[model samples]
Target: METIEKRKWSVNSVLLVLLFTLFGAFAVFPIVTLIIASFKPAQELMRFGLNLKIDPALFSFKNYAYLFTGESLYLTWYWNSLLISAVFTVLCLLLSSMVGYGLAVYQFRFRNLVFVLVLVMTMIPIEIIILPLYKLSITLNLINSMWGIILPFVVAPLPIFFFRQYASGLPRDFLDAARVDGCTELGTFFRIMMPLMAPAFSSMAILQALFSWNNFLWPLIVLRTNEQLTIPIGLATLLTPYGNNFDMLIAGAVLAILPILAVFLFFQKYFIEGMTAGGVKG
Candidate 1:
């Protein structure tokens, strides 16, 4: 009976691995196709769209060369995206985490009400408030500025909620210890709690960076100038009624993936831990 049970377990494990392998291939298929498509000429892309079947002989470095040497404003757009994402991620993490930590740790009047309001804010779609936000941006003279993009959604609801939940799981003993040691409130947070919350920080860093990097609608509405456009907006302009620059578009897209990919890889070790801990803790 034991031998039979072992055999059954082995079979199940093998089947599970095969299933996951199939799913992994499916997930990776599009990215593989995009990378392959980047190497081909714009004419070939316009003719074939995106596909894996292509003549290797036709592939060349011209697309990549054009990205660097050509007069296209690809580099400017890339710099804009990187700067916006970095600043936004840092500000979002610091502010949202503090707000969340306060909610989780402090005993104050109407605290529950405040948290409920945050929840409600998360439920409310950005589309509903975008008009007011746009008007406000114009009033503040933030239009066509990077700060216009960064300032509006810096304290995003979702990250606040996540950080609150994660902070709730932390032990109050650390807070007491820090206070007893004569650490200031801000010092306590920075010195004592922030390190303990490293996993949460890592997880949110990736998520917030990804959001800022890929954000489209808000930036589109706020930034009017060509030079101020993010990568998504810039790449989108390549396709127009007059002509299409599929060569630069595809190549630019491939390069665009690198920053986000690097961020994920950097924080990946803590991501799963933070997510699982946050999910269960609060």
Candidate 2:
């Protein structure tokens, strides 16, 4: 009987491993296809579209060479995306985490009401307010500028909600201990609380960076100049009524995935922990 139970347990573990391996392959398939597609020429891509029918003879570095050496604006767009994502991620984490920490830790009049409003704001779609936001951007002379994209959504509600939930689970004993040690309020947050909240910060850093990096509609509305366009918009311009630059487009896309991939890999260790703890704690 014991032997049978042990065999059953081993079978279950094997099944779970196989299930997850299948899922991982599914997730990785498109990326693998895209990478393969990047090496092929524009004519092959136009003829075949994206696939995994590997042709060693057709593969060459010409697309990448053109992407780098030609007068393509790929590098400029990449720089713009990297800069915007980095700045926006830092600012959003700082501002939103502070607001969330305050809401979670402090006692004040109408505190519940303020939290309720934040929850409500999260439910409201950005599309509803985008027109007003655009007009405001125009008024502030932020159009065609990176700050125009960064400033408007810096204090995003989702991060505020997430941080608040995570902060609620923290021990209040630290707050009192810091105060007894003569640490200023700001110092307490900067030194004591921030380190304890590392998991939360890591999780949000990836999320906010991904959002800012892929963000399209807002940047499209705000930015008018080709030189100032982000990666998505820039890549899109390669396809037009007059001509299509499939080689540059696919190669540029594969390159564009690196920064976000790096951000995810850097923070991935803490991401699952933060999400699970934050969800359960508050």
Candidate No. with top TM-score? 1
Candidate 1's residue-wise lDDT over 157-260, tens digit each?
87888888888899989999999999999999999998998878888887778878899899989988888999999998898999988899889999999766
Per-candidate Cα lDDT values, in order, are 0.87, 0.88
Regions of model 1 farther than 4 Å from truth? 1-22, 273-281
| Residue-wise C-alpha lDDT for candidate 2, range 66-134, written one tens digit per residue | 878748888889889989999999999999999999999999999999989987887898999999999
Model 2, CA-based lDDT: 0.88
TM-score of every prediction relative to native: 0.89, 0.88
Give the Cα error of residue 22 in candidate 1, in Å: 4.1
> Residue 169 error for model 1, in Å?
2.0
Model 1 misses residue 238 by how many Å? 1.1
Angstrom error at residue 59, model 2: 1.2
